[model samples]
Target: MNLELTASNVYKSYNGNQVIRDCSYSFDMCDIYILTGPNGSGKSTFLRICALLENPDRGEIEYSSEQRVLKKDLELRRRITLVLPRVGVFNASVYRNISYGLAIRGIKGGDFREKVNRMIEFVGLRNKKDQNALTLSSGETQRLGIARALIIEPGILFLDEPTTSVDQANTGIIEDIILKMKEEHKTTVVVATHDKDQAKRLGDKVLMMNDGKIIPT
Candidate 1:
């Protein structure tokens, strides 16, 4: 497996309360890594660090490809998109919500439309594309959030408890889409969830975290 992302001796704290303690791990390219733990077990914090949303107090994260090296934070961010546990939909149409990331990245007109339409279709939200994003159900909103993330064409994806707010049908749909992403796009996925069933279903490797430490079981 290729080492797409690596963290070495990572430690973090908030007001002297240690959250992550000397944790180190590597994410392989095109593989699904599941971080399974109880609430407040530092899974999301670890993911935030990997996504570069938050800087580690002490650690080094490296990302690279075969021909190009992702050395800077900006380069890594472009390649890795993080979907938070709570879906925050913009007060806009579902189409806009799906196309927002591309719009911010200077993609407009037909290019953005093509990508957004494909993503909405992939997430099975094509019918709701014209509806207000904030008016969608929790499950639809989560699917919309995932579509938004996928529109960025990220090489690595970080999902924090992606199934929490979703219904069974949508959860199954999202699971299929994620499996397809791994098979087709070869995107490395790191998911943080306390759901053991989901971990077993999607994870190629499971990191069981507890009490601020990763138990390599």
Candidate 2:
């Protein structure tokens, strides 16, 4: 089932200062999209609205599958995941951090252990599986965040400047993981970035933004 997410005439403002202005776009399932722009251009805000992390001050966001509209609810939100620029991790072990979501959803025992272990290895953190998440470097922490987000197999993934604080080596790894998710899991990806090279490398389609509006590429 191919899902589609659409936003129409979206507008957002903070402290009475307009951030996103009349933005509209549609995203289809299993494709990678890049939202590129400069600082304060509203890329993150726009992505948040689409990911259902924030509501638009004006306009509507709709989800549909096979041309039939679906309700926007907790279930729908569960299918979409967002990874912010700053990496957030639990104070516990890397194993616990990645397994938290799975455990919440009732996965346990051998099934739970397998999933957690696989994800840890996939993110190149197997050697650090028992290490405290807070002790990880920026790159390792970012990888952990990606592993956590992907463990649940979200239908749509929103990455807001995910590599902004990452080193070049880790940036390449993150980019590869993003591509791998799209190709293997068929997870629809929406990435907001300022790096033109990264956009070209990973984006199936690019949407350029400026001053809270999407500009023609």
TM-score of each: 0.93, 0.96
Error of 1 at 189 (Å): 0.6
Model 2 pairs in collision: none
What TM-score does structure 1 among the candidates reach? 0.93
Q: What's the lDDT for all of these models?
A: 0.84, 0.89
- Local accuracy of candidate 2 as per-residue lDDT tens digits, 1-217: 4468988999999999999999888888899999999999999999889888899999999988888888988778777889888867889999999998888788889988988898898889999999999999898888899899989888788888989878999999999999988888888999999999999999999999999988646
The residue-by-residue lDDT of candidate 1 on 90-172, one tens digit each, is 99999998998898888878877888899999889989999999999887887888889988888888999999967898788
Off by over 4 Å in 2: none
- Model 1's number of clashes is 0
Q: Count of backbone clashes for each model?
A: 0, 0
